[model samples]
Target: MTRPPEPPPKRHGVLRLWHALRYSWDGLRAGWREPALRQELVLGAVLLPAAWWVGRDAVHVALLALSVVAVWVVELLNTAVESVVDRIGPEWHPLAKRAKDMGSAAVLLTLLASGGLWAWSLWAWWRG
Candidate 1:
């Protein structure tokens, strides 16, 4: 006899929230596990608020906030890329190193862009 198909998973609201929290907690844990990430988080937290204060209007403040968030987003993506690359090969590999380096470069680009945005906005506000 043929076996029956499996039942669909439950979609309770509380359970969904719990799952979301679990994922967020996992990401937070991973971020804190790295010293670089911890430093980045501290820097972003300190800089974004100052940027907001120096921003003349809501638009500038919003742009500054988004730029800072962009940095963190890229870092998260870089971490994920590194994790996957490591999983694919436990041993040392040149290609894996290249992949990680590219991810780090992306994060660097994001941070540089954020710094540019913050500096330009603050400078304009200061001069005005």
Candidate 2:
């Protein structure tokens, strides 16, 4: 007979939150090893502070900051995808190629949108 399925790890309330935070920190640490992610972080360092200057008000600053955050989110996910794909095998495969391409496409879309928002926000600032 087959054995019973194992239960999920039990983490409750504050413990769960702590684990989540730790995992997020770990992910960031791992992301630092990636060149593209490192560049995005450096870019974030500049954009996050610039948001305060480029935005006209609180909402504008928040939007600008979030837009930069969005790029980080997308890039992190892309890096995750690439890592998984590489882990599967070193040999070339069509499915692996597709997955990596899709991840890159996602990053490209996010970057374009973020750039557009910054451009529009800056133009608005320049007008006055």
Candidate 3:
């Protein structure tokens, strides 16, 4: 027998916002629990303040901060992908490997982009 499809859950106004915040907090906690994510969070803690000190102006500071945050965001997403893939099974599979590898690659690209932005900002400041 065919089962009916589930209807979408409804959330309204303030309640929706509250749920969103709660979900975000849960995600952050999960990320913090993950080793790689914990490391990135620590890195952000150090770099965010340094970004403010090293940046030349408000725009530079914001850019630096956003770049650092971007890395954290990407890392969290990568962790999510890995977790989901791992949950699927313990057996070896080409698609699982590809999914995990791609997630890692995404994190690497974000890190590289963030690093390049910071390096450029420093170079510009140095030249001034």
Candidate 4:
């Protein structure tokens, strides 16, 4: 006879929040294994505090911080996509290539946007 299926996982209230946090932490740990993500995190470490100096006000400071964060967000997404594609099997597939390429493109776009924001913020701060 077949065994009974496991009960559905909890998905509400404080338990859910705790589980979500744990999952997010796990994701970060996985991301740390990626060299590109590690590099970005290192840069973010330096830039986050530097934002205090680069920002002209609270809003600019928050914007600066978020700009750095946006890069990490994209990098994590790219990592996830690459992982999934690689998991699908070692054999090359056109669609897999496309998906990976698109994910990379997304990361590049986020990097560019974050860079632009930082540059603009620095320029505005310096001129003042």
Q: What would you estimate as the lDDT of candidate 2?
A: 0.94
Model 1: per-residue Cα lDDT over 1-128, one tens digit each:
99999965766899888887888999988988877788888998898888668877888778888888888888888999998998897998999999999999999999899888878887787898
In model 1, the runs with Cα more than 4 Å from the true position are 1-12
Q: Give the alpha-carbon lDDT of every model.
A: 0.86, 0.94, 0.91, 0.94
- Model 4, poorest ten-residue lDDT window? 7-16
Q: How many collisions per candidate?
A: 0, 0, 0, 0
Per-model RMSD to reference: 5.1, 3.7, 3.4, 2.7
The residue-by-residue lDDT of candidate 3 on 6-63, one tens digit each, is 9658899999999889989999998989888888888889999998888988998998
Candidate 2, backbone clash total: 0
Give the per-residue lDDT of model 2 (tens digit) for 64-115.
Answer: 9999999999999999999999999999999999999999999999999999
The runs of at least 3 residues in candidate 2 whose Cα sits more than 4 Å from the true structure, single-residue gaps closed, are 1-9
lDDT, residue 76, candidate 4:
97
Worst 10 residues of 3 by lDDT: 119-128
TM-score of 3: 0.85
